[model samples]
Target: MKGIRGRYGQMKVLETELDSTVKLLDTTIFNKDNFYNALGRQQDFIIRPLLGPQKIRVNPVNNSLYIIESTNNKQHFTNSEDVYEHLLKHEFTKKNYVIQTVPANNQSVLHYHRFTLHRISSSSNWKVVHHSITGGNELGKIRHALPFLKFNKVVRNAANLLGNYYLACNTIVIEILQNKMGETWITDTILHERNSKWSQFHSLYSCKALRSYIPHTELCTKESLGKFLQSLRQVVLKPCVGQQGKGIVKVTKLDDNTFEIHENKQIININDFAKLYDYIHNHYLSKNDYIVQQFIVIGKIDDRLFDVRVMSQLDETEWIITGVLVKVATKGFFISNRASQLLTLEEALIWSNSKISFDKCVSLINEICGKASVVLEKNCKGITIIGFDIAIDSNGALWIIEGNYAPSTAMFYKFKYNEMYETIYKYINKNKKRFSPHSD
Candidate 1:
């Protein structure tokens, strides 16, 4: 009997009797002598590295079996028929696995994706084909090359904890599990904090390093707003659960007698405190759950506000900094969000023209973001990926502006960081079973 070991891009032979030890073979430069030496006086074996469209050689004189190594894990076979069956299992699983996004709207199919091979599906809950009873359909026969089959297993991902919602697969799920919050994590986090700004403040304030970075934030009540406006020259009022830079109003005191409010790149000079107070009362304090925060003077590139968006993922054992890019805001825009231009770390350094050396800045961003992720992960229950929005001030001090659990990994793909993007998906696919609550 012969044994096979499979890994992506490579395949090795294992001696079935001698403790199932693996014998590595150099596939590119085939060495018959090396293979003979590794498994001498035993059954000679053939190994094939089957990438897409690659040929696999068959030895007529010897016994051989196939091992299919998927990106997620390994599968083994004892014969060609079994190998075909295993391949069918993978294809069927890929076809069946579907992710229906939250809100279950007309766009639910848009978020459907298969975990086996990372691809968005045009349809969900694939049509079940009962090939065993009636000769399989043409598509089933062509795809699986089998006449009879049984696939009754239900593929379930995520949980009903948040009412059967499907959060996109990746590091975002880690944050939901860790924070015990679902798709509405932001709103949930605020609500869980007793609907107070201090709750969000206290969550991060527990970390010593993060404490210094957090601006002095207060609930936007009449008394607190007055105190903040008097004390800080530049203050920002943010809607508690808002995203994408929406509903953010920046107020900067010009003098004791005059101040300016900047929102959506439009500026209005308030002549007196009454106007400022009225603005706050009508636009923010009374209408929304707003937080008043001292605004940090973030570094800019070409006079456009910019910040570093660092993507990190928790792998099997440790955290990894997957990708880092600088997001430059649109001209005259204060927020560097999805609508902003993205720059590679090197490009960002060149554009900023800061005194700090490029290599040193990269190292600092990676270290700071990595450490910050660890702190957030430890504080939360099971956070996997942290998209840290880090800001560098005029003085070169690094401050983490925010940590987004469900950040878009599209930046990595857009910047041609496919390898890093794939690594994050590989981790997510490997641990997909744990995505459901209590699976750990």
Candidate 2:
């Protein structure tokens, strides 16, 4: 009673002496000995408690109610709702006390921030849950068994207040850079200048070994288009910022001084240079930023072109390749993507019919990817994760197709690469490494 009296002494005295009412609430209403009086005092300031082991205590210096949760008692309340139970148990008691115990384990918050793209409303698509550090399975499982975290339906943005680490899950590149949560790999965009294709081209163009992998690409201009067509009998046109084969066109020069443009199932032939220019210029090139590149005949599997998708991440100081998938082009499609059938790296290698050994290819791919990552990390800030889209040509040489900052991992998951996926997330969420570019 003395503790409660001291905690609310100022407010209690103010109410008694003034013969007025006071109320306090936080996610729930606080009972004032007199219910009617508390209801009436709703018009006045109320002190509500935060959901934690913290109690509403008074700061005598300022005569204000402040939260007090002891660090020593955190382990006892690993399940946050234990705090609520403590509050409920002491609700009608004459005296309240918080039992403190030495913390045997420590846990930190990992907040994933998600929001719908192209939406006007500024609301959070947040899920509050605890992911376990260890589980029955080898892969650490999400702690859905914890009742408190499981039922937390509301989005809580108390990272700053609670010292939680925030992760920009599904957030755009801009958000990752702006959020600035301890220099992670998600923001590595060293080669991503304006778009992936061009950014990758310019970034890798300097390395002689990587030069062959990068096709002859340039911004689509009238003069450059003609030269590109004249030099390379066949050229591919792609949106500088395209994905999943959207807005792609293949142009082939014919013997009759005409051009054949293939897009999806439709093929158009233009005999006049001016007409061909107009057809491509207004309809495709001018619509958005476009890049024209020399076409390389990709290795095929049963007559279908296939490309490799490698997902890599920085673990401490080492870059680890987490997942590898081979994307076979969909029937009649120019690009290999989600719609295309995917095969394991081993299966794809067998289908590829390349002379290079699997071990050698793996070594080359890793070396190239490592070099790219180093270059990217040097210039691009906040990029800790990268996905490389690579192609193996008929000549058995590797070509760099594109680099992605926010690549999809569905392929890995779809192909049953759970171990790799789990490892990547475990590293990210747990983040056990002491090395931080921002660390002193």
Best by lDDT: 2
Return the TM-score for each candidate structure.
Answer: 0.53, 0.53
| TM-score between candidate 1 and the true structure | 0.53
Off by over 4 Å in 1: 1-190, 193-198, 416-418, 436-440
Candidate 2 lDDT tens digits, 351-387: 7787667888898889888887766554354577888
Error of 1 at 239 (Å): 1.5
lDDT of 1 by residue, 378-414 (tens): 4454667777788877777777677776678787677
Q: After superposition, how far is residue 43 of candidate 1 from its true place, in Å?
A: 95
TM-score of 2: 0.53
User: What C-alpha lDDT does candidate 2 achieve relative to the native structure?
Assistant: 0.52
Evaluate all candidate structures by whole-model CA lDDT and list the values in order: 0.51, 0.52
Residue-level lDDT for 13 in candidate 1: 19
